[model samples]
Target: MSAIMKKAWGYRYWVLVILWLVYIINYFDRMAVLTFLPFIQKDLHLTPVEVGQLASVFFFAYAAAQISAGFLADKIGSKRVMYIAITVFTFVTALTGVVKNFGQFIALRIGLGLGEGHHFAPAIRAINNWFPFKERGRAVSFFATSWAVAPAIVPVIVTSISVSFFGGAWRPVFYVLAIPGAIGIFLLWRFISDSPKEMIAKGKLSKDQDIEEENVAPKKLSKEEKRKAYGVFLKDANFYVFTLCLFCQLAVYWGTSTWLTSFLVTQHGLNIKEMGFFASAPYIVAFFAMMLGGWLMDNVVHRMKPVALIGYIGSIPVLWMLGSVEKGNTGLLLTLLLLVGFFVNLNFGSIYAYLPKRYPKEIVGSATGLANGIGQLGSFISPLIAGYLVTVGANGSQDFSRVFIFFAIVSAVAALCAVILKEKKVTKVPANTIGSEKSVS
Candidate 1:
């Protein structure tokens, strides 16, 4: 191997690390609001329904933007899309501190959602660009852990800042969180490239054995061919199944994550400081769970469907237990919540690994975006439904039984969808024939 090739290989893992950092900031900005909800509620005199609407508005905008972002990433490049998204979202996150009323808060949430909505697909596309097929699951899972890590850390950080630095003021917490994201904009711009081809073209890498072997260029497709590929994706039954499975999983995920802190405070009688600390427990467990899930997918199972099936099925009982546990049984509740976290996230790496691999590189971003976009509708609706279910009674208490049942049912459906999902087998045709052909069971 030439010196350039060796250096590029050495730097490949750093790319994953950088993206991981970006994801941490991405989720930190997204989830810090949840920790601040109680303060925001008091400050703005907003009802639970309206608070739920704030989260819903973000998801609505987020879901709406995914397809366009994915298409744009594929057409232009992931690097550009990611840089623009991080910058826009960082600015929006800083502006989150400035909203004084419900309308202003909702508008800022919408803007934040629009900015962040573009992040996932492009990040996945970048993973596809960097890692080999066999290693992608582990790489993607490592990236996915930001979901757990951000929540685990952000709640503590935001809550601490709210209590200490801002005297329980939530706005300054937003401003503090936005700074790291602003810094990330420069790091990404300086370090990231769309593909190894760009590096080679720019003479950052030479045509050497190690680099050449790892950086095989993807097959090019004409515009008509690309359109046909998208049509095939739409017509395929597996696409619907996968997308629905993702939708159900996200429903369970966002439903629980969005409301768990409030539930702890209201239902379990934990104070804000206690809620912040305990709220992190589940995701703390989930951090390791997701890492284990990723490693298993890459090394042990080596298939997406069965891993997802097991995860969704396993989560049902735990979620039911979480819902049924007696109020004030904080110990049991936290345990069940942790188990639910573990099971629910087992599919994180597998889903990301599966979707991009199933489609042509030319449309991988589109397929990923479509699945995530449609799936995020679950994120949009689940919180709203939960809010409606947990209606504040005359005594100012909520009955959480119905909400728990809803999440359990959603998880059960996700497991069923996983069971029915058919993985496509791709066969390379002759070099002179069309680019590739895929057959689905």
Candidate 2:
């Protein structure tokens, strides 16, 4: 083997580290807004319903963009899609600081959603390119840690800056948060390739070395062939079940993430700083929960449905306990909320890992995109429903009891959907199948 190839082989894991960092910044930009919502609501004189509408609008645009983004990733390559998405969202997030009215705020948020929506499918494809199947659950879960880490850290960062440095102004926080994304774009552009084949072609790795032997790259397909493959996905019953399961899971997850701080502030009477601290408690537990769940999925049980079922079923009672806790019981409240976070996030990595595993590499991006896009409807609707529920309470006070119960019911539905999801054995396709216009079966 050439010296350069040996070096490249040693450096393969570094690609995962870079992707992990990008994932962190991806979520940091998204979740930072959650922490800033109270400040934004006050500054714009918006009602709780309006605040919820803003979040819902972002998810709507995000959902709408997913399928197209997936198609684009499959066509142009995940590396290119990820780079463009990172650049677009970072610019939009910085522009968020300059919006003056609700109209402009909504427009910029939609733009941010469009950009951010392209990120995940491409990231999943990239992981599939870099890691073997057996290790993918752990790798993806490690990447998924950004979900927990972002929420845990962004609250403290945004709250500290908004209160201390910006003197309660939230605009500058958005502006400053865009910086990491800018750096991420540069790193991804310089370091990332679409697949190991690209690296080998570029003389970065040896042709003889079988770094990814277990997960061979799929042959490129013609446009007609691509359409036929997607048609097969449309006809698959398991696809709908998996997508529906994700929809239910995300509905409960996004609803809680979007409104948890607001719930604490208005319902529990906690101040912004106190709210930030308390809100972070659950995600801290979630970080460990996600890691443990991923480890178990990769090492012990290979099926995602059972793990996801546990997360959803276990979350129901914890969510109820969260809703029932009295205002002054800080310790008990935090404990219940922590469990809620743990259970809700337990399947984060496994679900994404499961998607690509079920589909051939040629259509994995499409499958991921379609599932995530349809799943985002849950995120798009749940916050809006919760807002309406909270808004209808007496004398402008929000009744979170009803909202919590609603999420519990949603969790139950998600758990049931999980029970219905069956794992499919992936079949190998012949090289001759790549150019054929016939539907994949």
Candidate 3:
């Protein structure tokens, strides 16, 4: 590669790229179930509520695991925690292909959740370790694209395999899905380190690079110090506000995403192929929308709240329209879903940009983990609640319109919480981490 090319794809960006790919696999495992939900529901003879439970249980387990994952990443190092998470979840994903009953299905979902839950906080911590506050908007925003792209691709990829290779078997797609996780495992082990310093030591990163945490080695915190870190964020009102905001955001994201297939296939009368195309459309738009949102956060607003507030407020009408669109109005459905994808996803760039800036680098993982964990409570509730909201028409077909209305209301709650978050600096980022970073959360 040319020097300019190498500089553009340098270790800093490569780290982000690796984490992004891993997260893509993570969503693939999570959302593949949703994509295959109608198939799974039929094959297993499952109720809509039961299908919701399968998705909900994963978040419950995922939410429960986040705090501990953060602490362990802080304590042991992100590399190891990530290694373990990847191993457990990939194994669980493959096991999913073999599930013959509901009990086994739920078990795999929880296992997937528990294993996947640990990956995010640690990956965020690793990014915080490398990028300074200024570059983080782009770095984290790009990483967040995995969330958008993976979901956009999942419906198509899984549907194609189910139809073409396996003759519509949902089970075999899990086996295919597990391949990326295996590749991610090798990538994580081979190239990634917990911090830039470790990468430098391994000679993967060139010496004398202008990177944060380039000289500071990873530290293992004592029990007393860990407690003190937790206490620091605990006292910050922004912590509570951010967590609540995440809860609301998760409701909008997971609640809608978890049930998207059913909403398209069941309510709108789209076939699996049509559902795949329509479902992929929103997330495809989200990739560009979120990228623009992140760029705006860095150069335009120079803060997260204004940008995010706009997103939260903007999503309300779109989500409501998404639900209210009558069956067979394919044109309106496409337009509304596209708008939801754009407005709803715009929150992430600013949302993720705040964490590493707001908390001490030593405890960024814990802060992120705890906030995300608490936020996932919203993730846990929305799907199951949406499941319950499924109305049976006189024709006995299920309608999921009420679920989008629920998300619309929850988006308003998120907007209110976003209002509570402060823009002023809250915690001092250690000089080694960011050369005097201000609180951005």
> Each candidate: what lDDT?
0.80, 0.81, 0.82
Number of clashes in model 2?
A: 0
lDDT string, candidate 3, 110-207, tens digits = 99999999999999888888777777787888988999998777777788888999998889888887789889999998768887677667766565
**How many backbone clashes are present in model 3?**
0
Across residues 1-441, which tens digit of lDDT does each residue of candidate 1 receive? Answer: 346433555556777889999988888888787767777889899996788678789999999888888888888788899888998899888888887899999988988888899998999988888777667788888899988888788777777778998788888888887789877887787777777777667766554444534344456667766666676577777889999999998999989988787788787788867887777788888877777777887788777877898788888888877766787788898788878888988888778888765765666788888889999999988988887787577998866777888898999999889889877643332234333555532
Give the lDDT ranking, best first.
3, 2, 1
What is the TM-score of each predicted model, taking all chains together?
Answer: 0.92, 0.91, 0.91
Q: Whole-model lDDT, candidate 2?
A: 0.81
RMSD (Cα, Å) for all candidates, in order, is 2.9, 3.5, 3.1
Worst 10 residues of 1 by lDDT: 426-435
